[model samples]
Target chain A: MRARFNSLPPRLKRGLTVFFVLCFAITLADLVVHKHGDHWWNFFGFHSLYGFVACVILVLVAAWMRKPLMRDEDHYD
Target chain B: MINAPFLILFAGAAISWFFPAALRKPVLLIFPVVGLLNLIALDPSQSWTVSLFDVELTLFALDRLSFIFGVLFHIAAIIGLVFAWHVEDRPQHLASLLYPGSALGVVFAGDFLTMFVFWECLALSSVFFITARGTERASRAAIRYLVIQVVSGVLLLTGALFLFHDSGSVAIRALSLDEPAGLFFLLAFGIKAAFPMLHNWLTDAYPEATASGTVFLSAFTTKVAVYALARSFAGLDMLIYIGAVMACFPIFYAVIENDLRRVLGYSMINQIGFMVCGIGIGSELAINGAVAHAFNDVIFKGLLMMSMGAVLFRTGEMRGSELGGLARSMPRTTGLCIVGAASISAFPLFSGFVSKSMVMSALLIEHHEWVWLAMLFASAGVFHHAGIKIPYFAFFAHDSGKRPREAPAHMLIAMSIAAALCIGIGCYPWLLYDNLPFAVDYRPFDIPHVVEQTQLLFFSAMAFIWLQLNGLYPPELKSTNLDSEWLYRRAWPSLYGRLCRIAGWGQARFYEAVGSLTNALAPPLRKQAFLLLMPWSVREMLMILMILLAAILFLLFLHRPL
Candidate 1:
């Protein structure tokens, strides 16, 4: 993931990478408190961990969609 | 006497359709003046009813409530027509006539069915005003508005049917609050009156209309709904809650809205909230308060719309982000807009102060403590957004360096007339009160009431000032905020798209299955039919022919016996 990020355009990629790291850290902290309901590895199994993963997925999906349909601010009026 | 006002209005509308533009405005202006004369000339002490198509159309009831609303309607119509005098379209002028005529019909109708007809008329006529704006957005918004309004009419008709079933009479009068059907009718009125979440149509479409067109749009529909709600649903307990919520919810949104006209639209909803709560309390004072507030709101709100209409007319910009420091050039319009904003904010000695307080007092007397608090907060909210935001953004906010000229003389004259009415009614509350359906026992100028309102509003203004200086208040942003309209605007569209996609896939699969089935059945069906007619089956056919020959011989044997 670090290698993939370092190869991309710096500003936008840096912004997304920071966002992903913050989200991942928040999930890790939440799972530490929640303890994933029962297990020692529960932090990795928590819903927020999945949520962070979903955020990353959505970011990639959104980027893909934006290429085709993204528009100028004055598109409508 | 009752039909006189409507007849005048209808005649004006009919003439406008055929009359040249030179004659239309003057002719339209004359209709409302004649209506004003008819209204003033009506005998307040007597009730007169006329029958049309075997239906009793109460013409001049002169009940205090109808008198207040009717008189206000006449005045508003006159002011609105004059404000839009520069509009050259014949159909629009014709529509303007029909709109008010229908409102008068609703106001004066003696029966539910009569009211329903006028109710539907109001919906049908007002669409033209929006459509006349001639913008794609305006046309779309107008259609949405028409659908909501027409749906309200349908609900009203359905309610009327049930009401007739329940009571076996069509005579319109105050109704008992205990029935579901009556409640349905109230919801219908509530929707048109723009009760809270049902309000976005007013803001959405009114701003999108032609500059001159919106002036007429602001006055009639919701106020007429308030008149209906006050007539039928006064004192229904739930109305208090509904009305309280109506008063409170729109201010924050109005405060942040970029579209100045749309902000006024939100403020319109907020103002109606006061009247609705007053109706719910159902005291003579409270109902009077509602009637008075409706009367005041129509004038001042129309004036506000006119001022903004003036701005839009000259500069062609309606959004707050696109307009500022207009006061330097359009000083007259800026002054008039401030008068409107002051009246709306319930500034002490303003029309809002005189009328809106009666509802608040009714709450206090009824011991509705929390509702009263909600109302007071809403009152402050009104001041913060409409009273301040409107004039501030339009006249004095960050200057955009556009120096549009003053509005035309006719527009200023129309606005002045409305502004004068706002002050006239405030200074002499009895002018409105004496005509209410009930006795006028309430006075607006009690010292304690004045002081308290002054303190409340003045302090609220101070809060606004402090917030502005400290950057604590949310600045007006250029984005559309979601309202109840989100259900139709966003949610329903999404749900509809999803349903269409699912149906498309289902149809594709069904067709595919049918195609495969047809391919599978073709050979077998053909073979079976072919086998039945094959040469191998010729012997069976010959046997059948031999059987027929045997039957014929039996018949010949029977004939010999005969």
Candidate 2:
């Protein structure tokens, strides 16, 4: 199990395939499934796009913040 | 007989402190169970009251809201004690009992005086958990935590006095924001709830406590604040914005935080934000959502903390940079942590979904469209940081070439119990809904809600994996990221140090000039008449506040004016 865990990158292709497949599947499900929308719920995959974009922006903004905020481990000491 | 449910815990604390070591764990375990049973058997119509010098104090009152919170504290205490089963440390053990005992006290308190005593106890007892670590950082953090907590308590006291003066009663009731000293109540509860600027102590201190100690730290303090806010200031429009900021700001900090436990701490604030927002919404369904979320958060958050605690227990490392591939060694802990992550992330069938969706829906019901959007962004951001970063870096990121044993049986048992509650609550929310303070009309498992929540979570994962593959995600490193506490810890101290140096220089010049004048005229006056001016002390400010409070107390109680 440890050896298998170590070889993480080689399985990226399969992982990506499954990921895209699931993403496409979820988008389709939204069209077929009966659902309620709060705002802009008409667009298929609106939530997917929102979640992805929101996450990306969150990480980028935080990474930018680290420049001034990050300090040495013992900075306070 | 003697305030059965909560005081039993206080008794257990005393027993554990004075009794033999071998009996401690069994005693601790039995107390929460017995407490829960006692709570269940208690008649809600019964009220414990005492007349104290013309003031009526309801020592213990059972209502639907307090009932659920009492149940939660017991469950949290049990899980927390089991997690700390290996801890032979007396202070930590005693504090574990006393801390939750106080939380239950706060929950059941029907008057200000009863609430204040236990409110302060919540702070006083919990500090032992941090001090139990016996490190310089923990010691400093403990004192800072205690000071902030004490200030919050004092604010509560001040608010209660003014409340009693204004209404001629000290009962816990819905206070109008315009009421005299109502702002004090908000500030007091806000500080405990970690409202925006007042939040850093939680993120600062929890990560520094010992492993099991962090679990207890996570459980009680903030949730008690949430309960207090819900009880007192529900429906305040201003809280909507405050809750939104509380929900949104912490995720960014969580994103960059190296300490995994501190990341959880930030997200803890984020979770409480939802509860606060629901309280602001003040609708029946919204209050139910807030209360249920508080219930679920204790279990799921404790589960996450327990997993991290187990890792810290075994490997002695908590930073994401210093941890990796722990799943290979402690597979069960990894699996349980992911359960916690998923629950917090609000996937379709997790505890957070049932409760968080209700708050979001309440936002729309109240026409808080922009706050709703901010909350949605927070959902995504929390998933990015706590949901993904915690498990990925701590368990499955590039193996750091370190392996450690699985957590002890007791710890795993504790984690499993909490994890089970997370899934159980998600799967059978009616088990939670039936006990809520209001009738929960919200349906979390509807096709639209489930589909939408799944889309949000999956795409968040899609972004995380993409960022990781392309090296766009920020790498965890051994560094401290500054937050609000930096004002007191870094900026204020250094600023004060420079000010002290300048003051010292001024004082020296003053003395030298005075010496020269004295030598020329009166030699005897140089040392004795040097200065009547004294440097400022924080104690003096506290003294003034105390004197004011004493005067108010005299006016309120004595009814005699000088």
Candidate 3:
């Protein structure tokens, strides 16, 4: 699954991923708006979503770095 | 009073230097016995005096506060000696003596200067324990530990100098926490006590020490700082917030930590948080709680360290990922470890319950509702990690097929002694509470209080179960979870590395420019300068002769004219 995902073309991969993420986030935001009040809830929700996406990107970069550099437990010892 | 403690320390160091390797461990055990005897015999009221640097010294004054901490320190030393009885290293043996002796000196010293002297001694001596591991990690940790410890001591010295200038008194007694010097002194103590952000050194360094060395390290530095804080900054308002945060931050880290020793390290800071918060409250009840919890924490926390130390010693492994199913083979150690976990988690009828409840209850009665709530959350978090996670992963998690034998007799004895103390104090709270520096009005064992505590603990345990069973909790894995130390350890190192590279590049460019300029100018400048001075001696000689003749004629003319 990971290899297949990695094999996708960069532009198609980028567009589809962003479109899905936006849809999911908007749905989640709408659900929150339905349950809670609008102004403060929308404000916090959008900021949190942005932060989450950033964190995910960072994690992906970290994962990429880790692939080659990772060592077994007794590496130094 | 003075003879045995200092003598035993010197004697231990001397024996370690001269004695056979086989005899050193036994001698290490002997020092603590002699020190404990000296400690138990001292009277707080009848202090023996020595004069130093125009200040009166009470080398063995057992103040109410000092007496309790002194006894605990003595007990911790004895327990640590037993735990490390199998260790053969001469440096470790020497360090074991000096570490506690320095703490004893700090506890008993009558003046700030005396305390500062021992305070620095404690820092200098404890580094050996970390350094003895002889690993790169240990070496790095030791350096960081030494730097922080020395910084604390320097701050203490600075505070002491300022204090002397302001108060014209050298006596180490209670002071208002508002003064600049007082804040410095409090920070010095706070760093050692693992006060929130000031804490990283404890967790960063302890896990890197030799397994046995860690047990000794865990007890003294922070508790001594707690003693200092209780003495100086009790009732300081900021401590409440600092302590609350201290209690909270370690839980997440501990939950995800694979190294059981490092997990215990985080737990150590969490336990200290309770004590600090108690000190902040500063009521008789709160102070009593702080002192009592400090006592209980040393025993149970040391017991936990001893258990983990045993595992590390036997397998040379401490990470939870590499450990599991030891209970099948090492049931005694597992049981003991469970006892420690229970005590730390404040399980009802355990030591943590008796002591920690006092601090929590004090917060409520004082009407600091938010702090009370935070303490409650931290309390549950403590159970989530130190109480359950430690024992679960180390003893009874996924079977790793490792049939490690039980700990050595001496290590077991050490752990049993600490475990027994945990139970003893829990069963009889009056024994601990009555001996606290302040009078105790808070009762720990009312029916309603007991029920409420039980419910809170049971439900938190239930929450832990839910999290674990549902796979919602963070799993312990083989990875380094970053802590505040990352600011200096990782981030600053990378920053410094970048800066050094830039500077190197700049230097290379500058040197290249200078080299080219020097190469271009060298031949012409050298030739021209030499050529300007290349006159023949004959030409100069004739000119000099003519000038001499002219001077003589001119002299004759001037004489005739006159």
Q: What interface RMSD do all candidates show, one decimal each?
A: 19.2, 3.7, 13.3
Better of 1 and 2 by DockQ: 2
- Candidate 2 residue pairs in clash (backbone atoms < 3 Å): none
Residue A18, model 1: lDDT of 74
Q: Choose the strongest candidate by TM-score.
A: 2
Query: Backbone clashes per model, in order?
Result: 6, 0, 1
Task: Give the winner by DockQ.
Answer: 2
Ranking the candidates on TM-score from highest down gives 2, 1, 3
Winner on lDDT between 2 and 3 is 2
What alpha-carbon RMSD in Å does predicted model 2 have with respect to the real structure? 7.4
Q: On residues B1-562, what C-alpha lDDT tens digit does candidate 2 reach at each position? A: 5955778999888877767777888887888888999999999998888899999998899999999999999999999999999998788888988999999999999998789999999999999989988999999999999999999999999999998888889899998778876899999999999999999999888998999999999999999999999999889988888999999999998998899999999999999999999999999988998999999999999999999999999999999999998899989999999999999999877898999999998998888888988999999888888898999999998898889998999999999999898999899999999999987777788887788888888899989877876678999989999888889987887887776666667667866987888678765645555443656588987898899999678544433222
Candidate 3 interface RMSD to the true structure: 13.3
Tens digits of per-residue lDDT, candidate 1, B147-265, equal: 99998998888888787777766777777657657877887897899877778788878888888778778889998899888888789888888889888777766766778999889
- The CAPRI quality class of candidate 2 comes to medium
Q: What fraction of the true Cα-Cα contacts (under 8 Å, chains A to B) does candidate 3 also have?
A: 0.01
Model 3 docking tier (incorrect/acceptable/medium/high): incorrect
